[model samples]
Structure formats: C-alpha cells, structure tokens
Target: MNGILETILVIVGIIWVIVFLLALFLSPKLSATKSKNGGKK
Candidate 1:
C-alpha cells in the first residue's frame, strides 16, 4: 500500500511540473499578444 501511494504521488508531481512549465512558457506569449493588440480596449 505504501509503495502504491508513493508511485501515485510521483506521477502527480510529474504532471504538476509539466503543467507549471507549460504555464510559464505560454504566459509570455499570451502577454505579448495582448500587448501587440495595443491594449486598445
């Protein structure tokens, strides 16, 4: 039971890292797009 829990935790941690990286990578692009629109709104 303990081993299973550890494996699940590791998998979740990996997924979290991936999502964090994606957010970090895309945030600048999104900001750039907004800026490019010249904030006319």
Candidate 2:
C-alpha cells in the first residue's frame, strides 16, 4: 500500500511539473496568439 501511494504521488508530481513547464514556456506563444486577434470574440 505504501509503495502504491508513493508511485501515485510521483506520477502526479511529474504531471504537475510538465504543466508548470508548459505554462512557463508556452505562455508567450499563447499570449501572442490571443493578441493577434485583438482580443476579439
């Protein structure tokens, strides 16, 4: 049970790291895309 819990925690941590990195690295790209639209609907 303890081992399983550790594995799950590690997996969640890895996913969180990946999301954090994407947000940091790709935020500029996302902003650029939105700005190109002049914030239109």
Candidate 3:
C-alpha cells in the first residue's frame, strides 16, 4: 500500500514537472503573440 502510494505520488510529481516546463517554454511565445496582437482580446 505504501509503495503504491509512493508510485502514484511520483507519477503526479513528474506530470506537474512536465506541465511546469511546457509553460515555461511556451510562455514567452505566448506573450510575444499577445503583444503582436495588440495586448488585448
């Protein structure tokens, strides 16, 4: 039971890390697009 919980926790942690990294990588491009589109809407 404990081992199962630990594996689940590790999987969740890895997913969170991936999401954080994708956001970090794409945010600049997102911002650039927003600015190019005039910063609103």
Candidate 4:
C-alpha cells in the first residue's frame, strides 16, 4: 500500500511540473494573442 501511494505521489508531482512548464511556455504566446485580439481576453 505504501509503495502504491508513493508511486501515485510521484506521478502527481510529475504532472504538476509538466503543467507548470506548459503554462510558463505558453504564457507569452497567450499574451501575444490577447494583444492581437485587442486585449479582449
């Protein structure tokens, strides 16, 4: 049981890191798009 829990925790951590990196990478493009769209969300 403990081993399963540890694996789950590791997977969750990896997913969180990926999400963070994706946001970091996409934020600039998102801002650019917003600007092109006249800053309308």
Of the candidates shown, which would achieve the greatest lDDT relative to the real structure? 4
Highest TM-score model number? 4
What range of 10 consecutive residues in model 3 has the weakest lDDT sum? 32-41
Candidate 1, superposed: residue stretches over 4 Å from native? 36-41
State how far residue 7 of model 2 sits from its true place (Å).
0.6
lDDT per residue as tens, model 3, 1-41: 99999999999999999999999999999999999999875
Score every model by TM-score.
Answer: 0.72, 0.85, 0.85, 0.90
In model 1, how large is the Cα lDDT of residue 6?
A: 100
Off by over 4 Å in 2: none
lDDT of 2 by residue, 1-41 (tens): 99999999999999999999999999888888888989553
lDDT (Cα, tens digit) per residue for candidate 4, span 1-41? 99999999999999999999999999999999999989878
Better of 1 and 4 by TM-score: 4
Model 2 Cα shift for residue 3 (angstroms): 0.4
* Candidates 2 and 3, the one with greater lDDT: 3
What would you estimate as the lDDT of candidate 3? 0.96
Model 1: lDDT to the true structure: 0.92
lDDT of 1 by residue, 7-34 (tens): 9999999999999999999988888898
